[model samples]
Target: MEPLLTAHNNEATSIAQLTAAQQKLYQWDKTIAAKHLYLIENKDTPYERLTTLKKHLAPLDATRQRDLIARYKALQTPPRGRRVEEWLRSWVEITNMCIAADVPETMGSRAQEDFLVACRTINPEYGTSGLRDLIDLEDAGTAIPSVEDYVSKFTTYLKRVLPLSTGLSSMAAELDVSKPQQQNKDGNKNGNKTKPQCPCGLKHY
Candidate 1:
């Protein structure tokens, strides 16, 4: 990753001119970089022994530092899997990172949408449904009046429907297939019990 510090320096006239949110995000980036560099320089010493570490950098709130660290870690990991919860968290991370950097709103929006589309492409049957549902809900005058609201509502929908999703049902099918099939009175296997009827009738079984 190109250092965010240099990126801002090249784009802005001066650090003092940055907005409050921009300044806070810049400080976070600088702090994380500083900590990593310190560890590199003191390769022979353990992190726990770095007693004077914080003293060398600008002070940040404990809670904010923890949040920044978590966001930073999420950025370091590439988004993976078609799972709704996993994908949504990754999408949020990208959006937060773009916002922190003060990138154009359009750019951030496009990036988020692209990520969702990619997930759908990789798993059409399961993945496409989530994005489709999001659109449907948005068009129906639901609570998605803004991007933040859209994400929040979609996340809630994913959580509510996850239990009845085809992914879990498929896993159940695999487990059932592993066991010996019980024979019925006419010598036919009792296969009907293996796959339960999905209540929603949405092919989630």
Candidate 2:
């Protein structure tokens, strides 16, 4: 009886979450499909598709447009990882791509600098080297704002841009599976040995 009740409870929980998630996913899928259908029905070319996206996005403020473009790009390259590092890596990649693609210089050259400032502000030991290397810092001397400032501005940007999506929410909840992990040689737990410290100086158990 206990096992049967547990199964029923689990099924109920799964159904509730799945229903909510599926509703959102279905809306997203329908929006994308409708865009494609319109293009096909109108016999629009790929250039037309890009033009439509650009025109649809043009009325938005510059920062908001940049955020929308980032979301569009993220649809192409979904993130993977569970750690903060994973999120950072994905952000760096996306930001760099946007920069390279000449989307718009919303973050400016001091984005990495700003992030470092935020990290330091949050925790001095957050001093992880190579962050500079990870991001291109050709112009670091400029006075970039702190991470908090960037987040505030970015949030404002997102709020302005989020309304552009046909059904896509301005916010997305990404699953984190890419956080860094320490594993033993044979895939066992870190065991009783005193493992070496990570480059970030964090000791593993």
Flag regions of model 2 displaced more than 4 Å: 1-34, 40-83, 100-108, 125-205
Q: What TM-score, over all chains together, does every model reach?
A: 0.32, 0.29
Give the candidate number with the greatest TM-score: 1
lDDT of each: 0.49, 0.43
Model 1, position 177: C-alpha lDDT score: 40
lDDT per residue for candidate 1 within 80-99, as digits (tens), equals: 33344555565576566555
Q: Taking the tens digit of each residue's C-alpha lDDT, what string does model 2 give over 31-138? A: 544434343234224455456655665565577657757653443332332233343444555555555556643256444554544344223333244245334334
Model 1 score (lDDT): 0.49
The window of 10 residues in a row where model 1 has the poorest summed lDDT is 166-175
lDDT for residue 81 in candidate 2, whole number 0-100: 28
**Per-residue error at 170 for model 2, in Å?**
29
